[model samples]
Structures are given as C-alpha cells and as structure tokens.
Target: MPRSALPPLPPPAHLRPWLDDAVLRADRARFLTDLSRRSLGIGRLLLLWAVAAVFVLGWTFVGMAWMDVERHEFFSYVHGLIYTVLGVGVLIPAVFWLVRGIRQDRQVRQLLHAWVESDRDPAADARLRAPGLSLVWLLASFALGVLGLWVAFGAAASAGPSRTTSGELAYIMGTGQILWITGLLGLAKAVVHYRWAVRAFRSRN
Candidate 1:
C-alpha cells in the first residue's frame, strides 16, 4: 500500500452545541440518580434501625418506674409491665425478620447452587430447585425466641420501682424481645413440622 493511499481518520459527528450540552446534563443527572439508590443501601446494612424505636419506649417505662421510689409498690410493678410489653412487641418481629429472613436467604442461595435433583429428577423445575427453609432451623429459631422473651421478663423484673433506672436498657430489652418473637414464629411452624414428623404414623392410619 502506498503512503498516499492511507485511510484518513473519520471526523467526529458535529452535534448541535445546545443539544450536546443537554445530553451532558442528562447524563450527569442519571449518574446521580443511580448513585442515590446505592447510597440508601447503606442503611439496609444495619436493620437494627427499625428496632431502635422500641428500645426507647422500653427504657422510658423502666426509668419512669424507677423514679416512683416505693418498695413493693403496685404502681411500680405495673410500671415494669409497660417496658416489658414494649420490649416484647418490638423484639419478637424484629428478631424473626432479621435472623430468619437473613439466614433463609443465605441458605436458599447456597442450596440453589448445590441442588442435584435437577439432573436426576424429571419433575425438578426452577421452583423445586429453589432452597426451602427447614422445620429444624425454624424450631431452633423458636427456641431462641422464647429464650429472648425470658430475658426481657427478667429485665423488666430487675428494673424495679425503687431502683434508679436509665432509658438505655431499652436496647437490651428490645433485642431480647426480638429474639423471643422471632423464636415464636419458628416455634409456630411446629404445626406443619409435626405433620411431617408424624407422617409415618398418619400413613398407617
């Protein structure tokens, strides 16, 4: 090939000045909007934020009861109940959602990969390959949840009317309650679990 026969670089298309500026502005705006979703994702890393409110409510009741300055006072006992309920209410669901949801999500992802039934079973669809939660795991959750509730009851009883209390204990009680409620959900699954457990007996019947 001769030097004079060399292909020249294609000139860039000339966009209208205002149109080019608009395109650039639009691109920048889109980039920012996309980043916003990722920025907001940081909060999801700490689901405890939702549980924080109940902690405050629980601590408040304990502090108020502690201020009553009475021994074996009925009012103080009732005051303790306020924190106890608030703690249990928040804890039960928070713990259930947080631990079980997170755990099941992880396990399913793992099982989805390891599932060999797809190869051997003709009926194995994508749904069958999908990982399912085990009753055993759910039972464990219920046990833990009940244990958490027990702790909350203890916290409530300890924050007596005569004792000086602070609002910070709400977090502890809230967490304890979370464990209990989540566990309850796990335990509640026992209805279905027992069905399978007694399947051998039911089959005979």
Candidate 2:
C-alpha cells in the first residue's frame, strides 16, 4: 500500500504514552517500577485509612476501660452511631460512589472507546486517558477511606482474652459495619482499576 494512497488517520505524537507500547515497554524492570509508582499512591491512601482506624479504636478502648461494664454498651452504641453517620448508615455506604461511579464509569468507557477506535488520532486518545487517570485517583481515595475504617475492626478482631486489654470489646463491632462497607468500596475501586487498565492499553498502543 502506497503511503499517499492511504487516508490520513490520527496523529501519533502525543498519545503514545497512554498507548500499550509505552506502558508495557519491553524493559521488564522499568515497566514494573513504573506500574508500582502508578499504583502506590492508592496503597498509601489505604495505609492512612488503617492508621486512622487504629487511633479511633485505641481511644475508644482506653475510654471504655476506665468505665464500668454498665457504661460499656453506651460506647458500643456511640461507636456504631459514629461509623453509621460517617458511612451514611452502612447499607448504602457507597451511595455517593454509586452515583459518582455511574458518571465516571461512563466517561471511562467512552475513553476506552475513543482510544481503541480513534483512527490513530493521539489528541482524542489523550483526552480519553485523562478521564481514565482521574478515575484511578478516585478509586485510590475511596480505598484509603475504607481501609482506615477497617483497621479498627481488624484490631478488635485480633483481641482475645490476653489481647482484649479490657474495654476493647466495646470497640469490636466484629461485624464492623463500617469496615465491611469499606471493603465494598475497595471492591468498587477494583472495577474502576480494571477500566483504567483497558483504557491504558488502548492509549499505549
């Protein structure tokens, strides 16, 4: 096929990064290192969440230990209410994300579309990758928030006769509603991550 006979497609100058070749560069070490950096931001968010949850549980347990058994249940209700309010009653803890995801997810899908079929137009693909990257950031935020909430429950779950340290039982919403909700949020993030992966592949290629 003569170059002159072919129809002009999209330019390939700017869009190469988001495309597959740039991302999965044959240099395995660089590829893994790059991927780690890209994914680490989200991991830190999760770690922060874990740290915060620990503080909350610790404070609550210390306060409860000072009180008698009769007063313990009060803290239980109090703890429950705190998390419920924070999470908007647990049942629909991810309500905001559900709403946000619908729009964001659509944008991501559209991004995938443009990248995959843009006729090599790098600018259009670049625009799509922007939304995809933003979506990854959003997922990271959600994961961090949920991870922090779970840390408290995880701490409580580890509590035993030797570990309870007294007053700690009250902090153990073993069925830590908030932690479970947080897990759900992380699960949602996985879906978003998958979408970004798809979009990233197209942009790189």
Candidate 3:
C-alpha cells in the first residue's frame, strides 16, 4: 500500500497506552516499572483485606473453640484441627506479603526517582492517559458497596447485643464488611476514571 493510502492515525489525546505499540516501545522499562508499582498497590489492598480476615477469624475462633467442645468432643477436635491449619495457612502468606510490601515500597520510591530524572516522550505520555470507566461499572460497584454495608451490619444486628461476638455472627459480619469495603474501593476508582474521561471530553470539545 502507498503511504498516502494508509489510514490516518487517531488524535494523540485519544490514543490508549495499552493499545499503542509506539507508546509501549517508547519506554518499555519505565512502563514495566510503573506496572510493578501498580501491582504493589493491589498487593497492599490485599494485605488490608488479609488483616481484616485474620481479625475476624481470631475472634470467631474464640467463640467457636469453647462451643465446639461443649457441642461434641469428636467434632470439637476436628474443628480445632481445621482452625489451626487454616490459621497457619492464612497467616504465613499475610506475613510474607506484609514484609514484601515494605521492600516494594522502597523499590518503588527508587524507581520513581529514576523515572523523574529520565527523559520522557511527549507522544507516549499523551497515549498513556487512560480514559474514563463506564457508568454501568460505577453503578454496579456502588450497589455492591451498599449491599456489603447492609450485609455486614445486618448480620451484626441480627446477632443481638448479647451475641455480637459469637463466632457465627462474627464471620457473617466480617464477610460483609470486607465485601462492602472492596466495593467501595471499586466505586471510587470508577468515579475517578469517569471524571477523567469527562474532563478529557470537555477539553476536546
């Protein structure tokens, strides 16, 4: 095909980083480094969730441990074994991730310093600008957040003041809290993306 016959490229402002080969190739190392930092952010979020899970599990065990023995000797032994195994399994990873996060934070800061000193490509920068998220996703995330809040609090309420710390009730409430918090984070990201998209659109118009 002749050069003139080739299709015209989209406007620079409209280019997407993930979709643009030129952007990816322009600074592959920086892109990958940035991606690592983003991954660390996700890891941090997971760490928070893990902490919450541990707290819930710890209290649930406190309630269930005695209940199990009272309910059935054989079943109590089995429950204790299961709890030990699960606790160890979750704890090991959570600790590892927590330690890793500290190292990752230091590395990210170094990388950020390097990135600041490095030269940048204007075209690539423009392409790296992410578009806004969909409205549907935003709404769905918000709904999930609402549902999570209701589930967490409702479970706690149902347990009554006398049994608020009961194992079964604690598990239900903790699960709900985690769900709502995750949903809330998602909703926040969606809103930010949507705002950015709107701003970009306005700039163009």
> Which candidate's lDDT is highest?
3
Q: What tens digits encode model 3's per-residue C-alpha lDDT throughout 1-205?
A: 2421212222243454446565544554445345333423344445545664664465455445544644557978788667656656665665676566556555543443343233344443343233322344456557767877898888866777565545567567766776686567556655654564355445544
lDDT per residue as tens, model 2, 1-205: 3421212232364875667763333332332223333332455345434643544454454444433343458776666555545433332423444454345444544443333443443443343333444456566656655665576567666878765654555544432544555555555545565566565665567
lDDT of 2: 0.47
Q: Any runs in candidate 1 off by more than 4 Å, and if so which? A: 1-135, 161-166, 196-205
TM-score of each: 0.32, 0.33, 0.49
Better of 2 and 3 by TM-score: 3
- Consecutive 10-residue window with the lowest summed lDDT within model 3: 2-11
Ranking by lDDT: 3, 2, 1
Each model's C-alpha lDDT? 0.44, 0.47, 0.53
**Candidate 1, clashing residue pairs?**
91-177, 91-178, 92-181, 142-183, 145-179, 145-180
lDDT of 1 by residue, 1-205 (tens): 2421212221133543435554544433333223222222223223333443444454455444444423457876776666566656755665576575456434433333232211222232222211233444454665677778777777876875455244435545765775676556445544433443244233333
- Model 3: colliding residue pairs: none
lDDT of 2 at 152: 59
